[model samples]
Target: MTTPPLSLRARRAIVMTAAVLCPLVAGAQTIAKPAIGPERPFTAPARVERTLSNGLRVVAVRYPTVPKVSVVVTMQSGLAVDPVEKAGLAQFVADAVQEGTASRDSRVIRREIFAMGASLTAFAGQDTSSFTMRGLADTLPAMMSLVADVVRNPTFPQQEVDLLKANTAQALQAQLASPQFVANRVYRQTLFGPHPYGRVGAAPETVANIDRASIVEYHKTYYRPNNAFVVVTGDVTPDAAFAAAEKAFGTWARGTVPPPPTAALPALTGRKLVFVQRPNSVQSSISVGNFTIRRSDPRWAVMNVANQIYGGAFDSRLVRNIREDKGYTYSPQSTFQAMGQAGLYRAVADVRNDVTGATLKEIYGEIDRFREGGPAEAELVNAKTYARGLFVIQNATQNGLSATLNTIYSFGLPNDYPETFQKNVSSLSAEAVKTAAQMLLGSQDSVIVVVGDYTKVKDQLVGFTNITFVDISGKPITPPQ
Candidate 1:
């Protein structure tokens, strides 16, 4: 059945009618999202402290309100301490601890922990590591004993080592399959460069090659009483807590602190733009950042404020620009991560495939803005308020106390850390924060990396004078196309 063809005027009328109705249809379908409730700050219980003859430091937090208790034995070591060849040694040792023991088998340990409803785990690092035990206050003693056994006498049995090696290899393979993982891994390598922090959590080759001897050696070298700090916080009194810890770990022999090797921070070589071409990525993961002050650096406070205003929270500059305005992604964030010796300030975001080039350009612009002039008074006050609010919440409970201890031990913070922070944070001025921002936010010295389908993004990225293409391994993808 053939109908008479409409004239051009009829077709124009049809198109206009379609356009007029489309907006109406869209408006009808759109619904405003519900407002989320205001955020509440967390508060910690009052703290009590004591020191034992063996130089064991004990801190007890009284929280008669909550039934749960959290205990931690944090030593000054963590992933940051992994040996050069064994990059993930701390993590591997952490995971392998409960595999078995001299007396109790791995299954027995697991069953006991299960029956007592205890959660226990161990983690190691360069500056600090810890074994954490958490459970009902009444069951804390039992959990403590279990953790004590693991820390004092882990038997990373041959069978367990084999199992862990296989498991680690499998985990490594899984992470390698992820674009985000590859992207971040490469960024760390480039940012940290020759620094230990630059290496991935676990070296694929090293993890596959690790055995019981290495784990045992690592444990013995660093896990000593004098070199560690034990903190317990819960319903118990200070005396009781000390006695309990002594009964479980008093016998731990004090050993000299390891003279860890010296670290030389390499000056950032140059400003560079790079990309890892994922065959079929729907979006791009971008990282723009530079090395920052060490954990103990005095500049940390200023950097903290600067980072917050830049992209510290949901309402930060990056999120506001990339998400609230352009709607490129849900949220874009930046963070300053420098552990024991040094950390890097980095901004990371995932943008739609088409927006990669523009997104990075905007990111660079923001960084440049900070270097050129720095944040205004409004941003400075807001960040300080936000940070103070965070400090209160972070120190609010037993978990919070454990966190405090962890941070202290990890970064070798001074005893007056909390007191000092309170004073510093309160007295922080806009001028001080701005100075910190100007010093740390140098865009000309920063690095940029983009991971996505380069074929679609390459033409857009041509504006950058320097662009290096990298494969998933961080090796150069080609001789600059």
Candidate 2:
């Protein structure tokens, strides 16, 4: 078949048509997105607080949006107070508390709670242990009773303790297989030295040594009405909530809670490197950080803002540089943990073994840049907006409100801390963030931890002055014969 070329007139018509359609397609692709509306003023619900005759504090907030209630009973006892020998006693007690009470076994407790379409959970952190429950408002009384029984009368059955120990031992063994876990464990120990905060998780041997008697004693010493508080949020009025609290916990006799344990932390002199050799690891998990200020520091707000701009979000400098620009890893994050004592500032990532050294260099560079100049005005504004948005999202529901209140009491913060946070973060300036960075992010003192094939990556870490090898438990390791 033979085809003839198009005439000049026809070609001109086709070109004009194509040009017109292309602009329409481009316009469709570039359609404007809806603008975000102005943030609504967030006024936290007024919380009513009362102290029972037995010294139990009850804090309640009314959220009558639905016929539901959220309850949390928090004890001031946590890992910080654990005896040196019994490193995991508090955690074991937290797990075994609900396994059986004087009147109900685990099965019966689970069934009863589920029968009411309710949920209950208990957990232990560095500073506090808490038991939480959520259910229909009508079941508030029953829920409170169940919570009190578990908190006051846990039997800590020998069989359950054995099972928990075995399960925890297994979990610990599994975690040791993960490079990220190894890096974090060693990083904490290196940063905090022998302080309680250094002991982030229980050793398998420590778990094995925990017994029923020690668990009972630990509970007796710490879980007292005088040492605990309750937060109730949902459909009930403050008076009704207080009455329920007294009915459930008024008879719980008060006991003395031991003062927080203290230990002198070993000084971190200069940059150090700790490596855990994972045989044939394809990726290296790296953590770099040092201790900073306590939760009560005046610069806490500035640190929060600076952290967001550094590596706290997807668009943060670390993430943007290493992941998006350099293609090192998928997600890299920086976190700040401000506790009663000196807090922790950590930046972490898992990168290919080949790029291990490069990743470390980039992390240090970003941190140095932040400390030197802080964030620009536009960046500061964006970070503050992000922080304020998170505040609103954190208290959007009854459960969320209850959790926030628990955090306030656990941290020894004032009742108006949320309001204070909103005001402070909103007013943060670029200069404030810069000052905070200079004070807190001292790169010279950071302890860098890397878990990878040491044989391949050790020489790559050339800039570090002091490099030590450690096992998964953070104990020093000897070179292979």
Candidate 3:
């Protein structure tokens, strides 16, 4: 028989007594932290490489876990190849490539892509621009053909070019209202000077200057088979993928690509500070940056680990100091990017106008602290684990694998980069990380950009003597007296 229900007073007494005893019982038991297991070995999927008679390179990797595939055709010419007078020409050409092809208009291209259950897109970066497509496994050949048509046969229709320019001009106006955009533009300009890396985007005036003739000329000069490669990943056989690439791109004529730009990066002697005055603003967007190394540098792994321990990780010293401890900002982050010719390290935070100086102080303090003594053994181990885990997760999908292959070939990395990446990250020593920090982590010789109401933050920024004042357009102006 079931026990009879207790009276209300009796039930309350029993619950209170059980709650009091549970803590005592829990305190008496000691639980050890579970040991972390050795990481399972990762075998990179086998990749097959082929070259077409016209000098187009194709890399195909077999990833049969899904029923789809991703393909990216990347040209080595990008923003760096943009003529100095035409800042956004490469990106303009990239965007226009998908607008219309010789055989099909944008509308027809979109319809065909939709019917195949596919997406087609393109973008330009500092060192490379790529046209990418993803579709069903059975549609691999069709996807390749479409991407080839888009890249090789862009018409750069005059009407489309004019509309794109108008749209871009409008977009630039909207972006300028953002303080972070202004801060970044000024910061990069300060760091890179006349280097192509500094020119992140075109101004409204610059966009107005982009015409169909320039777009066509830019594409003809750079979009050559000899200067590009295709990466395919998914549930497709290597032979089938290679044949699709060759069949699609074999007839495309190779062109002589101009030598890459060789502009010198500006030297950073002392702290270069700039302030963009956004009147009546309540917050400041700050960017602290310094030039570092190239993507293929042997020291890249060491620098990456150092960055993670210092600020790259969400739980890093910078985040802990500025966000968790001082509560100055939300989502403060630092990033290390390695480009084809150079690299950059940047830490950014948007803080309340009053606490901007305090946040900067803490950022510099954390950098100095990390550079002097390096990460502790435990911190180093944790960072390495995170890095290795991140690498695996990032490349565990078809899209990610294709992008990885794009980066490998774009930066001239060895074919076995995927195989060696985890091992390199795991092997970094604490001393090596500290050495990297000392070599690159900057406090004195850095570019600092702050965008806010100049009057509100000017007093806090009094310590900076080499500061330059600019308006939202990055045009220099006299600071308010």
Models 1 onward score TM values of 0.86, 0.93, 0.93
Top-lDDT structure, candidate number: 3
Model 2 residue 463 CA deviation (Å) reads: 2.1
As a whole number from 0 to 100, the lDDT of residue 166 in candidate 3 is: 88
Ranking by lDDT: 3, 2, 1
Q: The CA-based lDDT of model 2 is what?
A: 0.86
Error of 2 at 283 (Å): 0.9
lDDT by residue for model 3 over 1-481, one digit each (tens)? 9999899999999999999999988987876678987776567899989888889999999998799999999999888877767888888999998889889999999999999999988889889999889999999989999999999998988888888898898988999999988887888888999988987767766786778999989999999999999999999999999889988898999998988887788889788888888999999998997999999888988898888888899988888888899888988988899998998999999999999888788888888888788889999989999888888888888998888888889998877888998888878888889899987788789999899988988788878889899999999999966
Off by over 4 Å in 3: 1-38
In candidate 3, which residue pairs get closer than 3 Å at backbone N, Cα or C atoms, i.e. clash? none
Best first by TM-score, ranked: 2, 3, 1
Model 3: per-residue Cα lDDT at residue 425: 88
Which whole-number lDDT from 0 to 100 does residue 99 have in model 3?
88
- The 10-residue segment with the lowest total lDDT in model 2: 472-481
